[model samples]
Target: MAQELNQLEDASIVKELQRRLNEKSASLLEMEQMTRRLLSLNEQIRHTETIKSEFISLIKTEFRTPISSLLQESQQLVENIGNTDVVATGSHLHQQLLRIDFHMKNIFAAAELEAGETRNAYVKVRLESLIEDALAILQYVVKQKQLRIESTIDLPEGTLVTDAGKMQLVLMNLLSNACEYSYGGDTIRIRGTVEGDRILVSVEDPGEGIPEEHLEHIFQKFYQYHSGKTRLQKGLGLGLNVARGLVDLLGGSVHCTSAPGGKSTVFTVSLPLKDDREVKDTSDGGNDFMFEAF
Candidate 1:
C-alpha cells in the first residue's frame, strides 16, 4: 500500500512540472513575436523618413534654378517699367511682379539657410549708403500703410566690411515687422550709431508691445506674438528668425526689448567694423576719401 501511494505522488509531481514548462515556452514565443514586429515597424519608419528626405532634395534641385531666373526677369521688368512710359495698370502689374519676386527670394534664402548653404562673403560697404538704400526700399511700403517711419542715425560716415545684401535684408525684415505690427498713423523709429567697434541699429514701434511670456521665444521660428486675428499682424512668422540667423552669419548679434504697457518694442543689432584701410576707400591712386563722411 505504501509503495503504490509513493508512486502516485511522483507521477503528480512530474505532471505539474511539465505544465509549468509548457506555459513558460508559450510566453517566450509571444514575446519573441512582439519584438520582431516592433523591429519591423522601426525599419519601415526609417525607410519612410529616407523617402521624404530624398523627395525634398529632388524638389529643391528641380525648382531652384528656374526660380532664380524668374527673379532676375522680374527685376529687369521693374527697371524697364520705370524707364518706359506705361499706363497705371502696367505699373500695378510691375509692382505685383516685384512683390512676388521678393517673396520667392525670401523662400529661397530660407531654404539655403536651412540646408546649411548660406555663404558670408564680406566687402567694404558704405554703411550710411546701405541704410539709405534700405530706407528707400521701405518708403513706398510704409507710405502705403500710412505709417510714419523715421530714422535717427548719429554715426561717423564710415565703411565696414560686411555682406551688404544681407545687411539690407536685415534692415528690411525689421522695418517690415514694424510696419506689419503698427496701426495706421502709428510712429516707428529706427535709430543707430557707431558705438566703439560695433554699429548698433534699432527699430522701435509703438503698436503693441510683446508680452513677457512671448519675449523669450520671439526669436524662435514661426512664432507670432499676437493672438488677435487682424490683417495688420500676419506672417509666416519667419522674418525675425531669418533676420537673427543672417545677423549671426555676419558675426553680429540681434536683441529685443519690450515692456508691458510700454506699447512699443525695439529690435537692436550690433555688428563689428573691419579694418580702417577698407573703411577709407581710395577710388584711384589719388588721395583716400575721408572715412568720416560715408
Candidate 2:
C-alpha cells in the first residue's frame, strides 16, 4: 500500500511538471509573436518618418521658387509703383498668385489623400471645360517657358458625370508636369477621346522622357528619379501620385509610356463613362469656389 501511494504521488508530480512545461511553451510562442509584431510596427514607423522628411524637403524646394518670384515681383511693383507698367506687373503678380494657389491645392489634396479623407462628389461636367480651366491656370507657366500647347478634343461637348473638382486636379497635374519638363519652344499635345465606355485623355510632351525602370515607380508617393548628380525636375513628387489617386477614386486608370533615349513621354488617363443612374447628389454647397479660376 505504501509503495502504491508513493507511485501515485510520483505520477501527480510528473503531471504537474508537464502542465508547467506546456504553459511555458505557450508563453514563449506568444512572446515571439509579440516581438515580431513590435518589429513590424517599428519598421512601419521608420518608413513613415522617412516619407515625412522627404515630403517636407520637397515642399520647401517647391515653395521656394514661387515664393521668391512673388517677393521679387512685389518689390518691383513697390519700387516702380507709378513708373512700372501696371498691366505687366499686375499680370505677373496674377500669375504668381495662380502658381501659389496651384501648389497649395496640390499639397492640400495630397494631405487629404494620405489621411484617406478625400471623397469624390460626382456631377455632370464637361470635360472640355475642365481641360480649358487647367490650361488657363497654367497659361503663365507655358508663356514663361515659350511652350505651345496643342489640344485636340475629339469627344462631343456632352457632359460626363464625374467628380469635376478632382478631375480638374488630375488634368492640371498632367499638364503642369508636361510644361515643367518640356524645353522652350517644345509643344505639349493634349488629346481627349471617347473609347467604348471610357473617356481617354493623354498629355504628351517632347521632353526628357522617363526611364523604363523609373516609369513603373513614378506614380508612387514621394518617388523622384535622381539623374546623376541632379534630379530630372523640381517638384514635390506628389503630383503623379495624387493624380493617380484621384483617377483611381473616379474608377479610372492612369498609365505612362516613354520614348527611347528619354526624348518624349505620354501620360494617359482612362475613366469610365458615367452612368446617370449611379450619380450621387452632392447639392450641399462646399469648397467648389476654391477651384474656380481667379
Candidate 3:
C-alpha cells in the first residue's frame, strides 16, 4: 500500500511539470507576436514622420516666393501712398496679391490631387483668352527677365470645353518655367493649334535644356535634376507634376523634347477638342474674375 501511494505521488509531480512547461511555451509565443506587432507599428510611425517632414519642407519653399513678393509690394505701396505714382504702386500690389492667390490655389490643388481628387469642373473657355490671361499674370516676371514672348493661336472655333482654371494653371507652370530658365534676352515661343479632334499647345524656351536621363522623370513629384552642387534653377519641383496632373484630368497628354547639349527645351500639351453639343455647365459659380486679369 505504501509503494502504491508513492507511485501515485510521482505521477502527480510529472503531470504538474508538463502543465508548467506548456504554460511557458504559450507565453513565449505570445511575446514573439507582440514584438512583431510593435516593430510594424514603429515602421509605420517612421514612414509617417518622413512624409510629414517632406510636406513641411515643400510648403516652406513653395510659399517663400509669393510671400516675399507680397511683403515687398505691400511695403512699397505703403511708402508711396502719398506719391503721384500711387496708382502704379497699387497696380503692382494687386499683381503681387494675384501671385499669392495663384500659389495658394496650387497648394490646395496639390493636396486634393494627393488625396485622389482629380475631378475638375468643366466650362466653355477660349484657349487664346486663357493664354493671354496667363501671360498677363506672368508679365512681371517677363519684364524682370527682359524676355520676349511670341504667341500664335489657331484653335478650332477658338473654344475649349474644359476646366478653365486647371488649364490656366497648366499654362502658368509651363510659361513660368520657361521664363525662369531662359536668359534675359531669350525668346519664349507659345503656339496652339487644333488638329482633328485634338488641340496642341507648345511652350518652347532657349534655356539650359534638361539632360536626356532627367527628361522622363521631370514630371514626377518633387523631382529636380541636379547638374552640380548648386541647382540650375530654383523651384519646389511641383510645377511640372501639377501641370501633368491637371492635363491628365482633362484627358490630355504632355510631352517634352530637348535639344542636344541642353540648349533648348519644348513642352507640348495635347487635349481633346470640346464638342459643343456635349457641353454642360460645370462652373462653381464663384467669382474667379481675379484670374481674368487680361
Candidate 4:
C-alpha cells in the first residue's frame, strides 16, 4: 500500500509539472507577440514624425514666400505709383492668388478623398482646352524659370468625357510639377494623343532625373526623397498623390517614366475615351470646371 501511495504522489507531481510548463510556453508566446507589436508601433511613430517635419518645411517655403511677395509686390506698386504698370501689378497679384488657390484646392481635395467626401460629376470635357488652362495657371512660374514650352495637342475639344474638375486638377498638378522641376532655359513638352479609344497625355521635363528607387515612392503622400528646409524641392508632397487619386477616380491611371538618355522625366496620364456611368450629386459643392486664358 505504501509503495502504491508513493507512486501516486510521484505521478501527481509529474502532472503538475507538465501543467506549469505549458503555462510558461503560452506566456512566452504572448510576450513575443507583444514585443513585435511594440516594434511596429515605434516604426509608425518615427514615420509620422518625419512626415510632420516635411509638412512644416513645405508650408514655410510654399506659402510664406508667395504671401510675403503679395505684400511686397503691393507695397512696391504703391511706393512707385507711376513707375509700376497697373496691369502688370494686377496680373502679378492674380498669379500669386492663383497659386494660393491651387494649393488650397489640392489640400482640401486630398482631405475629401481621404474621407471619401468628393462628389464626382460626369460631363463631356474638352481635352484640348484643359491643357491650355493648365498652362495658363503656370505661366508665371514658367516665365520666372525662363523655361520654354513645346506643346503638341492633337486632341479635339469635347473628345473625352469624364469628371471635368478632377481632370483639370490632374493637369494643373502635372504642369505645375513640370514647371517646378525643369531646369532653367530647358524646354518642357506637353503632348496629347489618342490610341485605340484611349487618350494619353504626357508632360516631360528636363530636370535632374529621378532615381529608380525614388520613382516608386514619388506618389506617396507626404513623401520626399529629400526633406527639411534645405531641400531643393518645395511642395506639400500631395501633388502626385492627389493626381493619382483623381485619375483613379476617373477610371484612368497615371505613371512616371524616365525619358531616353535619362536626363528628363515624363509623367504620362492614360484614360479611356468615355465612362458612361450615371452621374451623382457633387459632394463638396465644388465649382464647375471653367477654362482659364493662357
Query: Whole-model Cα lDDT per candidate?
Result: 0.68, 0.82, 0.77, 0.79
The model with the greater lDDT, 2 or 4, is 2
Q: TM-score of predicted model 4?
A: 0.82
What would the TM-score be for candidate 2 when compared with the true structure? 0.77
What is candidate 1's lDDT per residue for 199-219, written digit by digit as tens?
888999887677788888988
Show model 2 residue runs off by greater than 4 Å.
Answer: 1-51, 226-233, 278-283, 286-294
Model 2 error, position 40 (Å): 10
lDDT of 2 by residue, 151-205 (tens): 8988775547778788899999999888887777889999988899999999999
Model 3 CA deviation exceeding 4 Å by range? 1-55, 61-69, 226-233, 260-262, 282-294
After superposing candidate 1 on the true structure, give the runs of residues whose Cα lies further than 4 Å from its correct spot: 1-87, 229-233, 276-294
Task: List model 3 lDDT by residue over 1-294, tens digit each.
Answer: 999999999999999999999999999999999999999999999977876687678677666766787787778778877888878767776776766666666666677678776555666778888888888877767877788999988775636777777889899989988887777778999999878888899999987788788888999876766454223235666788988988997899999999745478899999998766645454555323223323
Ranking by lDDT: 2, 4, 3, 1
- lDDT for 144 (candidate 1): 67
Q: Which window of ten consecutive residues has the lowest lDDT sum in model 1? A: 285-294
The positional error of residue 186 in candidate 2, measured at the CA in angstroms, is 1.1
Q: What's the TM for model 3?
A: 0.73
The candidate scoring highest on lDDT is 2
